[model samples]
Structure formats: structure tokens, C-alpha cells
Target: MLPPELPPLPALTHAESDLVDRFLEVLDLVGRINPARSSDTYGGLRAAQALVGRAAALRDALTLMHERGESSIHATTLARALRVLDGERRAARVTLPPAGES
Candidate 1:
């Protein structure tokens, strides 16, 4: 049996998965930059900080939507389940209301 605190893990739709994968690739790029390279001009450190910070924000938002009984809004993209609520027409689709505000 699953714990009550664990809101269901909705599988990411193809587009959602693609976006997350792209973000991971960007994160990989951010991680591969050499320490010295990041310190060069053009505010590299600040730019990296922005990227990491924004990614963290996105992660947090997705986590909240999936776990806690809160808004279904993702960082920028709504989940497949939510899109189903908007009457997505397809052969197969996931469907569910958010934790609250039915």
C-alpha cells in the first residue's frame, strides 16, 4: 500500500518528457563548464547561477504539483493529466483533477 502523503506519480506525456530531457541536457552543459571558464568575463558566474536557480525553481514547482495537495500549475508546461481536463482529444489520455479545486 502507498503512503497517504504520496500523491500519485503521473507519468509525463511525450512532450513533457521531452522538455524535461532538454532541461537535463542544459543542466549537463552547465555542469561540464570548467571552473576557470565560468569565471571569465560576460558575467559567467551570474549566468550560471541564474540557470541553476531557474532549474531549481522548476524542479520545486513540479515536485509540489505532484506531491502536495496544491495547484496543478507546472513551471511553464501543464501536465498531461491536466491537459486531459481541458478535453484533449486522442486515442489515449491521462485524466485527473488537481489535489484541490475540482
Candidate 2:
């Protein structure tokens, strides 16, 4: 039997797409840099260095959107996009584990 179909992603402008992609890149790097969860100092250091560029790219994406007059964020739609991209699980990695867990 086939698996259930996933919902289509919401329509987004080019800038919105760039923003989401850049944000996810930053989120993944942050997760990698979480010292509480990471064991390798070198790896964490690498991730920390990469984060600077990813953050700048994220800023550039937002700046492009602003320059293009996309002033209002469609939160509901963006949240859906994030969910579809496994952002909830990715974001969880950056947080401290619940008390008594980690």
C-alpha cells in the first residue's frame, strides 16, 4: 500500500522561499553548535563559524523582502512551511533537554 500523500506547500514569493531556506540552514547550524548536546568541541566550533555566514544570508533574505515591499509576514503560511520542512524537530535540537532528561 502507498503512504498517505503530504499536503502541498503554500505559494511563496522568491524572497520568502529564500528566507525559509536560509532560516533552516541557520537552525541546523545552531543545533549542531548546541554545546549541551554536542560532544565534539571541534565540530561545535566549526558550526559556530558557519553560523556567522548563515545568519548574514538570512538577514540578506529578509532585507530583500523588505526592499520589495513584502512588509507583512504571513505567519500561518510560513508556520505551515516550517512544519513541512521538519523545522519543529530541527528546532528542538537547539533547546536544552527538559529537566531531568539531559
Candidate 3:
């Protein structure tokens, strides 16, 4: 059972549902990758970091919705998540080498 502070899963629109699905897919991919064997050079760590941030943002949005009793109002959380993702992209570009490179 979810804790009392956590929100229940609210009904999502088609597009919102798709977004959640994609978010989960990215998270799953990040989870399955082996950093030592295959993900060391392709910004995998950064991608995983970004995905984690996204998941956090999604959770925040849901929580806010619960608090506000407005499941549809998620712009603030989405904006924050986008900023985090952009930072992750920039960090990856600066810190990681191109895929297949040493």
C-alpha cells in the first residue's frame, strides 16, 4: 500500500497516459542497461540520471495534484522536470564521449 502522503493513481487522459508509459519505458531501459559492459560511453549514466529525475518529477506532479485535488494541473512539475532533463543533456554532452569511442 502506498503511504498516506503519496497520491493514488488518478485517471489520465490518453496523452497523459502515453507520457507516463514513455516515462516508465525509459526508466525500465535505464534499469536494464549494464554500465560496465555496454553503457559506459553513450551518455548512459546521464540518461539514467535524467530518467530518474523525470520519475521524480512525475511523482511530484502526482503528489501536487493530490494536494490540490486537481489532477490535470501539472504544468509546474512538468516545467521543472524539463529543466532537469535539459541539464542532464548538457552534462552528458560535456562529460561523456561519443558512442563507440574510447
Candidate 4:
């Protein structure tokens, strides 16, 4: 059985690409820190510490986009890129597990 091909990622400017990368990094860290999902406090603490820097990077990416006159977010295009990069699964990890599953 063959897996279906993923859709091609939408074209993005340097700043937009950076923004998406930074945003995903932040999401990963947040997922790690999610108390409902995390098994160890120390690991969550580490993720929380790394989150401060990842968040700053995310802010920098957004600031660069604004400074470069990328005035509006192209949500539809960005959503495609995120989907290609598995953002849905990554984002889902930030939520609590289903009842009786955890």
C-alpha cells in the first residue's frame, strides 16, 4: 500500500518562512510543557525555559515581516504550509489527552 502524497507547500517569502519555522518551534516547546501531557515536571521546566528564547525568535520573525512591509497575513497560504509540515499533529500535542486515555 502506498501513502498519499502531501500537497506542495505554498510559496513564502523569507520572513514568512522564518515566521512559520519559529511558530512551529514554539508550538513544539509548548507541547512539551503542557502539564496534561507531560509526565515529568523537570522536563516541562526545561521546555518552559527554552520557550522564552523560542518565543523571542517568533517575535523577531513577526517584527521582521512587519518591517519589510508584509502588512497582512495570508492565512490560507500559511495554513497549507503548516499542514505540509505536520503542524496539526504538533499542535494537538498541546491539548489534554482524551478522557481515560492518559
Worst 10 residues of 4 by lDDT: 1-10
Ordered from best to worst lDDT, the candidate numbers read 4, 2, 3, 1
lDDT of 3 at 34: 39
> Would you list the C-alpha lDDT of every candidate in the order shown?
0.47, 0.93, 0.52, 0.95
Cα deviation of 101 in candidate 2 (Å)?
2.7
Error of 4 at 62 (Å): 0.3
Single out the weakest 10-residue window by summed lDDT for candidate 2: 3-12
Q: Who wins the lDDT comparison?
A: 4
Per-residue alpha-carbon lDDT of model 2 for 40-87, expressed as tens digits? 999999999999999999999999999999999899999898888888
TM-score of each model, in listed order:
0.31, 0.92, 0.34, 0.93
- Ranking of candidates on TM-score, top first: 4, 2, 3, 1
Candidate No. with top TM-score: 4
Q: Please identify model 1 stretches exceeding 4 Å from their true place.
A: 1-22, 25-29, 36-43, 68-102
State model 1's lDDT: 0.47
Whole-model lDDT, model 4: 0.95
Report lDDT (Cα) of residue 69, candidate 1.
Answer: 55
